[model samples]
Structures are given as structure tokens and as C-alpha cells.
Target: MSTTLASRASSTASRPPVTTVRVALAGCGTVGGALLDLLARHADDLTRRHALRFHVVRILARDASRPRSTAVERALLTTSVAEFLDTPADVVVEAIGGSCTADVLARGALAHGRALVTANKALLRTQGPALAAFGPRLRFEAAVGGGVPIVRLLREGLAGQGVHRVRAVLNGTTNYILSRIERGDPYAAALAAAQRAGFAEADPSRDLQGVDAADKLALLAWLAFGADPSTLEVVTEGLPRDVDAAVRGAARSGRRLRLVATAERAARGVTAHVSPALLHLDDPLAAAVDEENVIQVTSASSGTLTLRGRGAGGAATAAALLADLIHLFQPGTH
Candidate 1:
């Protein structure tokens, strides 16, 4: 039964329409690459459910010649920052870590009034105020808690509550090393295992020196209590370069070793510090091990809220990055 085009028009006009969300991605490292894979793998489900389609319009990396097994079309890769910025995109995601180019990209994107998202704790720790000056178009959830939605919880869940303090176990590499030590492995052996599992970086100095966790703690204080990342003084103690002593002491005392970050609202201001401490057997943090994180927020109204999850790994971090991307396009997100 064939119908005229004019007669069939009314029947086909009621179908739903779809809109695509364009994204400009910077960096193709672990988190960035996994993000691409996630977006591609879930595109159809996301579109079918949320009416959102993510299209990575451009990617900025140091060396485009570097081999990658991502789904992104080769034509989208660019080594030129200028070209990456000039490309039209609804959002710019900076996952490249470091102070130089990544900061430049973040600043460029924000200055251009583009929606900016980042999974870079180091960059944010160094220039949070500068980047945030670009307004509410910026969102960063992965920078602090890997896959845990702690940032959103602070912003939305406890929007009106007065947070008095935040205590967290923020580094997965150290946690994994300490866990291994508790299991009878030597400190060096544990460190090697963490590296083999991809939890620790090639130069794990930052993670071991407590710099990485301290940076993440500062970011959390800023979000949860409105503290300034720059002015926030974080007293840091890298988990003893060798966890053997700490592990032995904890074992003797019947405690668990965990590097904890604390931020308290004091009359002077918020005081933040990161240190490796022995946790009692029943302490909430005692359960966190190998690539796991636990963040506890004590607020005036909300009492205490605890978030626990895998705190390391590209997949976990990429999930948080993807959430930020989708929320940028979600209705009433801001």
C-alpha cells in the first residue's frame, strides 16, 4: 500500500529529533584515552536514554605521531594548540597533566567562554582561582576522587549545609603500597606491584611524597568549604618513603596504615594537612586498601557523609570525566 509523499508527511513528522554535543579533548593519556573509549562505547545508549550524543570534534596532544588505539579518527588529532582552540566545540576537556601546556589550554578555553572541564589536580591546585575566574562553565570531579562523585555531593547534596571538616584517604598508590606491606611484602616489592598494576606513575615521587594527595586535598577543601587552594596551607608528610617501619609499627599496635588528608574550619580559617597515620581496627579508613579511597565530610547540618570507591585507574577517572561532560549538556545542570 503506497501513499503519496504529501499523505505520508503527517505520519512521519512526529518522530523525535536528536542533538549532538561537541567536545574538544586535550591530552590522550590514560584518562583521556579511556574517556574517548567510554564516549564511543556508550554513545547509542546515551542518545537513546538522554537525547545526548557526544562528538569529539578535536584532540590536542604533544605528539600526534604517537601511536594510539583509540576510536577517534586520525584527522581529529592535532599538535597545534592554536588550531585546537580555534575549532568550534561546545566544551573543552583538559586531561593533560602539568603546569605548562595544560594550563595554557585550560586558560585558553576558559578565556574563550567555552565550557571547560578538567581531570588535572596539579593544574587546579596551582591555578584554581585563575581558571575558575572563567565562571561556572567549569567542572572537575575526577581531579579529586577518581570515580567518586564527591565534588557534586559537596556542591549539590550539601549545598546549604555548613561543612566543619573533611578527612580523606586520597592517594591510591600509597594505599596500595601500604596494603602490600601489611600483607608481608617489603616496601620495595609493594611499590613494584603498584607500578605493575598501573596505580603508580613511572616517577612516583609525587604520589610517595604526598604531593599528589595534598593537591587533591586542597581542591576538596576549596569545594567543600570555600577555602582557597592557593592560600590553604597543607602540611604534608609523604607516606614514609619506606612503609616497612610504619607497617611494623601499625602491626605491633594492631592498627592499619593509611595516608589521610584533613581539612578543618577553624577560627583562623580552614587548615589542611596530609599525613600517613595509623588507623584503629574499627576506623572507617582502615578498610580502604589498594587503589581505594574514603572521604568523610563532617557538616553542621548533614552531620557526616562518607564516600568510598576506587581512587585510582584510568577507567574510574574517565567515568568521572564523562559524567562532567554529560552534565554540561544536562538540563538544569548548573
Candidate 2:
């Protein structure tokens, strides 16, 4: 097996000259900017390892004049979607987020028969089926897990397995707040810390209200059980009003507070929810600290497969986006 694998790797590396994949990037914010840096820093390694080179042809940003990284060329920045879409490219990566403008870009990309990779869970939760109707050219490995690759696991690694349940810490902001609360920080202080660390936005209502986790859970349901994410109604409950008290209560009982997103497929139907739950210290979910996420998939064949990693931050999300690009355009992947 080792020899065969080595031979296959050698053959793949030796088979071709560099294949350049043109990319049209939407959004040059945190995730998009990090992607540009990743592309620039790892260009040679990506070519050597995968026989693939990435060339960004166009960039879509809200303010084209805003100063950006040196990796970005000023000439490629465009404020108009029409101009961005008109540029020729093999793949369109949408990291601007939200459902309105990002939705338009996603549709435009698929309309032109180009592959779409996005990190926007809100867009996917609402318009997943509509975009998926275009084809499998839609790839969103960054929509849920930041660096965890949970999407790939469900889509390919467990393709035919009987997946029954998915339990995860999908919202890093909530998890970080909870972890801090458990460690004796006040709720306000914990939230402030999360914001300072880039785990929470200044307006963190979506994360605090469980909307972010619910959106991610919906996408996970689509991947694991073939449910339409756009229509899956997740019963979501956010952080408790008296979260500090709840944390103290859980601690007294040797448990920790975690915002847990759960989806279970039953004979009757599928049920999903995002709410704060108490987990014993021994629980795998309890071991996740700060912005770390742990996703556990319970299936008939795979039993319980748990994946853990940094679940938030621009770099982690950017890396996932680049991973999707490599997966979609890598040699022999199709």
C-alpha cells in the first residue's frame, strides 16, 4: 500500500506541467485578504504538490479604493458585479458573506457554468437548493467548519454511510464566551474579550441569538441527511439571559456550558436545534475551549467520528476556502 501510494503521488506530480486555475474573488475583507496572502505565500508549494497554480483574475469589493494587501492588484478590484462577472475565470470564490449581494454573485457564477466556493452560511442556509440546482460545481467547505473540513467528511468520506446524528460547537463566538464564563470571567468581559480577539464581530447578534449556529446546522443537515438547508427549520435558542448564573450552576455539578448545535434524523422526521447545553468534563464537546469546535457525527457504519480544530478567525476560514479551491481544481479531481 505504501509503495503504491508513493508511486501514485510520483505519477501525479510527474504527469503534467503547471495547470493555472483562474479565480474571481468576491470580497477582499478578512477571509478574502487572507486567501490572497495564502495564494501568494504558498504558490510554489501548491504547484509542486498538486500541479496546480492559481491566478486571481478579478476581485469584488464594496469599496474599490480601500487600501488592501500587497498581494491584491488594484487593477483587479471592481465595485460592480457586472464588471466582476464579465471577467473570465474558472472559479468564483464568494467570501463577502450575507445572502443579498453574495447571492447575486453566486448565481452569476453558476449561470456562466463556473464553479462557486463560498464561506457564507446565511446565503447557503437560504439559497442552497436554488444554487445547488445549478450543479455540483457549488463547493462551500468554509461555510460551516472554519478549518475542520467537516463538509468534505460528510460529502465524500461518509457518502454512503447512515448518518443519524450530528452534534457540534458550530458558533465560535458563543463557545468562546461560554468558556470564558466558565473560567470566572463576567459575561460582559467575556464578550468583550471575544470581540477583541476577532472571534465576535462588533454586532454579534447573529452569533448570540444562535442564528449563526443554526445556519451552519442546516447546511450540515443537508450534507448528512440530504435535507434541503433552505427549508430545514432549526429550533434555535441562544444564550440564556442569566448565562453567568447558568454557568455557575453547571460548574457546581462538574459540567460546562456550551452552545451545542444538534441534528438527529429519526424515523418520523429530522429534528435540529441550537441551544446552550451542559456537558460533563469528560464529554468530548466539553474539551473544546476558546474558539475551538468539535463536530461529532454518529452513523451506523462510521460509529462516532469526531473532528476538532480552530473554528473561527480569518486565517482558518481562508485556509478552508483555499482547500476547497484546491479540491475543486486540483489535478485528477475533475
Candidate 3:
């Protein structure tokens, strides 16, 4: 036998076989359901290709009887946070939206030394550093840009790339509304359409008021510039009541109105903001229509790298979570 093959065989024989990793998922909403579907559909491939497999051991939800896509066993569902945390899990995935519950679940998972994967931008932006300091394995890849992999780009691919600025359109709900309005639909009608499409929440004030963008940009600022989310003075302004008029004015000026989220380093610190702005006809951001998100990163050595993709919906968020899961289970898989 070849020497390399002998070494591989010896290593495999000596090490204990890695069993399927147990995962406790919080929230069975859109993103959670999509994740369960993804895991179920690709379980065999994940094991064979990456030597990784996950079994959803427990599901945490306010209503244990709520319908979920995964058809989880009744015994695996729980309404109590304590019960969910007590389950033996190698990792915890939090798709819950609120800050209060998400914070507790995140802290509990970290206290138990379990790897945490979350899609909660609000919690991460508000308390990420503190929580990340407690656990060495916390990841929030799905928080910022859905499935765009911007977090991985900042944390790993561009670790030494000296990124200086990040400009993006991070809120897909607002983008969808604006696109529809630009196409002659009224803002209210557009917003209703977005909610119908599952791109906007029923309470879309967060997205329409630019809070969602602010939260996402705050997290990105922390990752890229080490700016504290609480300390950063983020100026935010949403689409004005006269957004349609602004879009028309921009069109007359050969421009388009886009909700822009920008983070730049200053001598004092990093400055971040989200607001409606005009993009020239040829600008890449101007072409980002509907629910698409585009991020442009300027690095010292790498210049500008822009990523564009679907920025909302369950499938995209679930895909980001899957990427994070693969990274955690098989660091060399990517």
C-alpha cells in the first residue's frame, strides 16, 4: 500500500468515529423551516462529501404545536427555553427574530460551550461582541447579507486584505418596496406586495425606518473596523414619504434612488449610516433592483469586491446557515 494511504488508514483507525452532531434549533419560522428542509434533503450528501451530519435533536418554539416543514417528532419540540437548553446539543441554531429571547438562548448555548449559529441581526448588532467574547465558536453568517457570504469574506478571505470601506444595500424589504414604487405602484401597495411575498414582515417599520439596515451595518462595521456597535454614531434615514417623487427626480437626473448603507473609517473612528441616496445610471448599486442586495468592499490590496444576490426569504437565509454549519463541522470543506 502507498505510504499516504497507510497513514490515512492509521489515522482513521486510531481516532474515534465522529457521530452525527446533535443540533437544537430555536424558532421554526420561515428560515428555520428552510434549514430543516435543506438538512433533510441533503443529509446523505453532507455526510459523504464533508463528513458532517446533523440531527435536529430539539426544536424551541413558543407554540410547540405550530406546523413546521420538518415534521419534527412531538417529543423533540419544547416551549420552554430551559428545557431546550438542557437538551444535549453540539450546536445551536437560532433563527428567532426578537432580541430578548435570542439573547438568552445565545448566552445559554455559549455558557454550555456549544457552537452557536444565528441569523438574528438585531441581537448580534446589539450584543455580538459581548457574546462572542464568551464563546470561541459563535458564528452569525446569516445576520448581515442573507446568503452573500460577506461575513466570511471579512472574517477569513480578507482577514489580511486591509478592508477600508463597505457600501451596501442591506435591507431587501425596502429595496423591494422601492423597486415596486419605481415601477408605478404606490408605496403602500408595494409594501403590501412585499409582505405578501414574504420579503417584508408584518411589522415592517423596522425595515422601512432603516433600523434593519442600521443593525446590519453596525455588525459589519464591528467586523471590518472593530467599531463598537453601541459607540458608532450611525445616521439613519429611510425612504421619505415623497420617495416616488425623489425617484422620478433621480431618473430625470439619470440616477436612481437606492437605500445605501455605508461604513467608512475615520481618524476618530468608523462612521456608519443607512439612508436613501441617488445612484448614477452606471453605478452597480443602481442595478440592484427588487429584493437583491449588493455589497462593495474596498480593501487596500484587493481594491473593490462586490457581491450581489437575493438578500431575503427563507431559502437564502437557510443557505447561509448551511454554509456556517459546514464551516463549523468541516473547516476544510469549503
Q: Pick the lDDT winner.
A: 2
Ranking by TM-score: 2, 1, 3
Highest-TM-score candidate: 2
- Alpha-carbon lDDT of model 2: 0.89
lDDT of 3 by residue, 1-334 (tens): 0000101111265443334678899987788888888899889887666666678999988887666554556688899999999998888999989899899999999888788999999898778899989755788889989878999999988887788899999999999988898899988899899998878988999998999999999998888988888667789998887877887788788888999999998787788889999898788888788988999999999999999998888889999999888777662432
TM-score of each: 0.92, 0.93, 0.91
For candidate 1, write residues 1-334 as lDDT tens digits.
1101111111124433444667899987788888999998999887666556777889988887888875757899999999999998778899888889988889888787688889889989989978888788788998988998998998889877988889999999999999898889999899899988877888999999999999999998888888889778899999875579879998899999899999898998889999989899888888897899999999999898888998988889999998987777753344
After superposing candidate 2, which stretches have Cα over 4 Å from the reference?
1-15
Tens digits of per-residue lDDT for model 2, 179-271 = 899889999999999998877878999999999999999999999999988888899999999999999999999899899999999998889
The C-alpha lDDT values of all candidates are 0.85, 0.89, 0.85
2 versus 3: better TM-score goes to: 2
- Candidate 3 regions off by >4 Å? 1-19, 70-73, 331-334
**Model 3: per-residue Cα lDDT at residue 42:** 89
